[model samples]
Target: MTSDDAAQPCPMPNAHRRLMDCHAQWHRLHEVYFDPHEFRLTMNSLVQNLRNVTWLLQKQKAQLVGFDEWYLRFQQSSGSNEIMRWIVKSRNRITKEADLELLSELQVVWHQDWLQRTIGTSSKYPPRMSIREITNDVMRRYRPPFGTMTVRRRWVDKALPAWELLDATSEAYTRLEELLAEGHSAAAVPMCDLEAHDRECVTSSLRASGTRPHCMVDAKDDLEAHFDLVEGVEIESTSLVIERDEELIAKSVERYGSRAEIPTSGPIDAVPGFMANARQLMETDGEHGTFVFLYRGDALIKMGGLLFYNQNSKILAFEKLASQVKAMNADGVLVIAESWFARPTKKEEELGTVFFPARDRLDRMEALTVYAATRDGKTAGQISLVTRDASGRAICAEPDDMDDAVVNTLAPILRIWAEMDSSTN
Candidate 1:
């Protein structure tokens, strides 16, 4: 019989249900880790849920084959694991005397010029701020080198094992999941494999229905990468303007060879027409608003587009688009797009905004920033003043020189393009 068919005949359904509840509690705890009040509330719920799973399983031991032996082994093993022990103790403390104590520590690292420098470290509670808020605050207080920042806040407790609270909780949840899975095996009920499902949902906020799986924090890297892009404008603000001139072009050509070209000194009369065509294509083809154009010498060779999702997905989407560009074996790529971006602002922080909202506003000047890179590790960007009238008709102005941050952002794409070119030729 299939796992689902076997599960229908299983006698220890309540135990399985409790295990699912425990998983839900753990997931909720992870979702509100930043908010101290919500975190404490969820932690209590998680502890109780974990206890219920074992208690329910023990009560249904007779129905589950080999469950008594499994329980004995689980008790013996979990009693020895320090974090597991702490979890049991915390549950008792909550039931008898008071809430468990929690301490939060925040670490801020600034990545600039190929170096990771710790900008701030502190232990605090209650008024726990979100990462974006903390980052904006840091920018307001200190003028660090122009680069990205990663803010990590971990909750801990002296009463628990010397591990981050989340790490300890994850361990406890994993052990309980193992116990539940073992119980299912003993009852001859097929257990639904959840590892692959969890991986698929890693970057999403949506929770899985029915039996929830152990979620891996795979989005941590993606979130940090997104933060880099979100805070890039602030970092780039400090860059000294290198006017688009012969000197800059000469430097680019020296580094990347004859294929490297700077943004044209004069406005391209064809940009408006190109943008209009792109808009038409997007409207009719149901393609993404953003378009990538590959050029062989002065002729357009290939074109592709991707829908701009949230900031977290942007990095991967861009990488995918870049790979397509490299596959075309073209000399150059020009990207045209309009998207909202969150920028660091001291004013918002000063106004006592605890949470910096996602990108909500689109500036006209920032609307038409074009990123171009050649197959020889050469990159350039231009900001064209794109204005819309009351009827929403757009007027495109001559493109201006973009900052060094754009170049930094384009570095990976350029490197990949150059590598692909080398491999092909």
Candidate 2:
């Protein structure tokens, strides 16, 4: 062995001072037997191993403590594995201790936002976000950096191989995986236990009726159900330490002791801005005008309400409106017609030509927003549009085809906006 292979003591501190002194004793024993430099390198490797193991163990514990009601519910049910997939993708990506806290807070925020939208303020208690919405939000918020393989491809090429390597090299990683699987099973345990109890109750009831033969079958089924619940049950880890989330703050000390506080003061007041924009667009005659709002990430959230104008206006006006909408990050359009013409109106044809290009064309339109207009001068049959489906995909319906029923229902809405023209004046 070369002189450069001399053993250097592991310099990092430990909790116990006595343990730290053990290094000197070890070096004395190995002084004549082993290459000192190789021993130093091994010590470095052991220190790194300890750090990596500690990180994984701490992460597992935090996840357990941080598991909110929504996440627990997600673990219990079967559906799109989007959240699991996201969690898998996010594995090994978080660097600091604070990231776990951030993730927990984000989960709570996502759940609360969904509840407010779905059940509104009428709900007695805060509700969790649906799996689908939470998954989409995660996908939007924690998008992979540019040039990374897509999620599907990465799962096959990178994630799977990494897991295999982890299992082979690190006992800590394998233990973490086992703990996670056990937690999932634990989440599912309550439901299974409930089913088993119910079956056992039925079995007892049947036996009381003197139907021994049928009861035997039920009794066996009940036993099997009970066994299923117990088969993979694991003791919850006591060593896992949970980091406290700082974002949840006290709104009131009396009624609601604590609530998840959003970082912002409150939800954005978009209506007033949208109305101002709509008014400006309607009053202007020649200039191209648009008001854009991002609802999610960088994409425009879906909204309702149609702007109406006289049909005699130049085709360029419609073209300009379509162009402005298309330029923004929007997926679909809605067009409202005041009257049911037997065939497509000139404006509809023009909008269709601009908004919905042939599927094969080089500039083929991906999606278009719908528009509405009032043809009948009477207040009863004005154009209208509304936001009906909050959860559905945004659409790009062609204006050329107006549904008779839709026109009948939305026409009254156009009448309500008749005062808009006078207000503009």
Candidate 3:
């Protein structure tokens, strides 16, 4: 039927009407990717190998592998190759994972809209136009960021201590920071910390993982802001290293009642900061690239260890850790990595499979600062973002709590390096 006809009420059988409705729902639904925006950006930037693989599979018999398959392969590949296609793949997988998280966000938004207009004014529930409220309304209680579950009634009282939305935000923020700090400190000594946090979550809230709460890079360091830069978008080293830092103070929990007391430090640093030497730089055109250099204490350990723990700890698993640079129809490329402060190999231990427009991109940008581990409680590892004179423009960075104007000063330094695979094709 035509558009007009489809909208018109028809004297069709009830069965026929139901079938058409179902058909229309499926046809109108967005089945491309769970998150259309991210999917589009990532997929559009697919490397040649990925593009080729995708096309080949699409043409023949190729089933897009799930997260695990792509992950193991991705971890094993070279840094350059790993960065290009593998990172995209892993992110795609995470996209699938964060579905629940995203759903939670959506539900909250819906609740606000529903409650704001009707809650207080209506004889029944009040209206709330915010997602948090909507989510709270429906779920009654959700787990905290630490991934700890909570009882609905208890969550409402504990999370909404004062029963005010403002308090809810403040509470959540404080708890989130504390949770992340605990992870960095590895302070789950009694093992009840995570469980306690879990127990505290409201039933309406989604279970939050207290172990290592998800972070949005420099979470607390933000000035209430948040990306579109394809121009000088360079792809440098994507190294995944697990190391044994001297400052690491993780005492063996096995010594429950032993004479040796548990050492003081932190839980673990999922993405801890550490400084490495600088890359070969070019004083002329500001064409600088960066890579992570391994340090003396930076021994490559398996990922599942305390310092750099991942459920799957095998180092050999990430064979795709080193990625290669492939040809692209874009502008200047860049790769910047602030690694373990230790140099792993004599010759860029893991050379990129793909070359840039210029070799200088790899040798250019050096690390300015790193997150140094420390045995001193007063000097525990910190989150630091430093910049060098790669562009001769003195780059100043304020603490994350600083104002926006102060923080935005260090906007992403867009420097283009070389082309890839020789433009002549």
- Highest lDDT model number: 1
Ranking 1 against 2 by TM-score, winner: 1
Q: Model 2: what TM-score?
A: 0.20
Model 2, residue 142: distance off in Å is 36
Give the best candidate by TM-score.
Answer: 1
The regions of model 1 sitting more than 4 angstroms off are 1-6, 110-120, 123-128, 146-148, 192-216, 219-425
lDDT of 1 at 397: 54
lDDT tens digits, residue span 300-321, model 2 = 3333222323221112122223
Candidate 2, 8: how far from true, in Å?
Answer: 38
Give all TM-scores, in the order shown. 0.45, 0.20, 0.17
lDDT of 2 at 29: 21
Per-residue lDDT tens digits for candidate 3, residues 1-425, read 22332232221122122222322222122122234354334333322223232233233223222423433343343234312333344345545543211111121111111112111111122221232343334444432221111111111112112222111222222233232223222322211211111222211121122211122111211111100011211112123343334433234222211223212222112112221111112212233233222111223212211111221111111111211111111121112323222223334546733233221354442223222221111112222233456646423233121111111101111100122232122
Per-model clash counts, in order, read 0, 13, 92
Please identify which of the two predictions, 2 or 3, would achieve the higher TM-score against the true structure: 2
Q: Better model by TM-score, 1 or 3?
A: 1
